[model samples]
Target: MEEKRQTALVTGASSGIGRETAIKLAGKGFQVIAAARRMERLEELARQVQGILPRRVDLSDIEDREKFCQYLSDLPEPVSVLVNNAGYSIRGAIEDVSLNDAKRLFEVNLFGLIRVTQACLPGMRALRFGTIVNISSMAGKFAFPMSGVYAASKYAVEAVSDALRIEVRPFGIRVVAIRPGFIATEFNDVGNEMTGDLLARTDPDYKPVYQASGAGVGKMFVNATVPGPELIADIILEAVMSDAPKTAYSAGFMSKVFLEQRATLDDDAFDRFLTETTGLTDLKV
Candidate 1:
């Protein structure tokens, strides 16, 4: 018997994990709609995917929420999957980051993600089938010094994915949280935009410790990084098709270890580990 084709909507499809996931899904016979602000990149992606529809929609904008929802609602076949993959890191302490930057991070990472899920819910419920894959990060589990805002946003995403999984299971909808470790991407570079001057500033006395710690993280990414985009995309494809997919998935080498460590931590041990790893001593902020 010929099977019906499923449709997936992937946000942040112009680049990185979202782009790769979209391609993988399309290759696996799912009709894909690749949404991102970069229309030229998306156009290129559309060419690459077997049967992908490319659309330019910035997930960060609150105003476009309704329009995007309406577009998906009117799709020929109901959207069977949604990859909430558009997000960027804002590197700074909470107090050092601007309110606008914080808002922008959450607008895409949390608010916009939730908005799209809410918008897609009716259709999913009506059809009695769907999967929601949220692209969280390792920082979602462990708070790095400069990534407070970004970590908070991803933490929110992790929480939402956890709760929504149970809430929608009765309606035949599944939510999967994908926590990726540091894969080389534009996120590393673009993190500067959100941090502004704050990234360069740490406690005057703790500068050396912070510098060394940052270097360690950079070295880890450079040394142990996995293939970007396609590797993550293949995982997403598996998550969508597997009847018994794990509620949460942590991809990449360091990501799995970091998340495991975070989950299994005693407060004292975690504190000690953090202090040692970051080269911190008994210093108060």
Candidate 2:
């Protein structure tokens, strides 16, 4: 029997996990809407995969995001699957990141996700069956040195996912959180660029702290085998395609090791472990 064509929306679909997931979903006979700030890339992806509808929207902008959400709400076919994957990271100590910058980060990483979900929820509830996959980072579990801003946003995502999962389950809406760690993507380079030269502008006392943590992180990844976005895209696809997907799935490099440590350790002990792991415990400036 021929099945009804289902629509799937993937935010941040211009690149990395979003891009890959869009391709995979389309290949599985989904009508995929690929949304991102980069229209050219989305266009390219549409060319690469037939049946992908390229959409350009800057999720960080309130006017633009609302317009996009309205479009989602008005879709002829309700979005049966949604991947809230648009987010970026800026490296800095909590004291270093400006309030304006932090607010902007949350606007995209947290607020945008929440608003988009809101727009889709009505349609999903009307249908009484849908899947929401939120791409939360492993940082959602614990903070790392100089990553407080990004981690805070993911932490908020974790909280929302937990609450929404139960709230919407009665409606047959499933929410799944995918926590990735250090995947091989332009994500790291983009984060570095967005953060700018951190040590150059930070307080002199923070220089050594940054250097030591950088070195600590560098050393840790020296022998690690970083996987590509396909690994995570595959997980997202599984969650979307499953009859009863798990509430959460962890993948990519360092996800298991770090999340396990965070799960097992108590507060003070975890604090020490994180500081030591990031080479900040012995840092003096």
Candidate 3:
């Protein structure tokens, strides 16, 4: 008899890393549930990839989340892999960013991720087999200016994944954190728009620091040989296929280097390093 195909659910599947991951998983013979807020885009993805179930889900909405969970519960096959890839960045100074905006970011990035994992845990535990892959960032390891809130959300993911890895191991569930650095995606565009809005209203005194940070970001993307989201998707594929996957996997250009530097440097030294490299100290805030 033919074996049952494993099902993998990938959030933020409209584009970028999530979309690539969905396609890759489907190629690997997993039934891929591709979910995002944009139904049309999901539909397009479904057309492109065989064995993909396009789902419209907005993680920030409580009602939508509940509905999605219900749908998952009713799936014919057990969800063997849960890829928490739905998240965005909000770029601004902490003081300049609105409280509501920050809260919304947390809603999607941190709380939403947790809720989805919670929904999947029962079934995973019951089956005694599963893998949870959380898409974190290099920023989670070490934060810089202009994207502190985004970093914080990823840091929360890191913390939660560490704890969850330990908690779920006994039940045969593997939790892995995939941290990607400077992937070419629409994320940068969204971040720039948020930063632009903040710059429009920010105090002139803080504008220089903000501009410097912006320039640093632009330079990183332009000069660095940033890989596309396909590389990350490949890493996720490996994690899914591995019987004993590592707790955390860092990928992309300079991701390991930066993470190593973060681990090696003291607080003061790290601060000074960031300041010098990003030119944040050239213009005092």
Q: Per-residue lDDT tens digits of candidate 2, residues 1-285?
A: 988899999999999999999999999999999999989999998988987999999988999999999999899999999999999999999899999989999999999999999999999999999999999999999999899999999999999999999999999999999999989988989898888998889999888988999998888888778999999999999999899899899998888889999899999999998888888887676
Instruction: Find the candidate with the highest TM-score and give its number.
Output: 2
Taking all chains together, the TM-score of candidate 2 against the true structure is 0.98
Worst 10 residues of 3 by lDDT: 216-225
Off by over 4 Å in 3: 194-196
Error (Å) of candidate 3 at residue 276 is: 1.3
Candidate 1 C-alpha error for residue 135, in Å: 0.9
Ranking by TM-score: 2, 3, 1
Q: lDDT by residue for model 1 over 1-285, one digit each (tens)? A: 999888889999888888888888888888998998999999987776688999888778767867887898888788889999998887765666779878988888999899988888888999898999999888778787767788899999989999999999999999999988867568767777656665356556555655666775566556454657666777888899999888887776577667777789987888677666554544454
Q: Poorest 10 consecutive residues of model 1 by lDDT?
A: 276-285
> Would you list the C-alpha lDDT of every candidate in the order shown?
0.81, 0.94, 0.89
Which is better, 1 or 2, measured by TM-score?
2
Q: Given candidate 2, what's the lDDT at residue 257?
A: 85
Instruction: Give the runs in model 2 whose Cα sits over 4 Å from its true position.
Output: none
| Clash count of each predicted structure | 1, 0, 0
User: Which portions of model 1 miss their true places by more than 4 Å?
Assistant: 197-209, 219-225, 282-285
TM-score to true structure, per model: 0.92, 0.98, 0.96
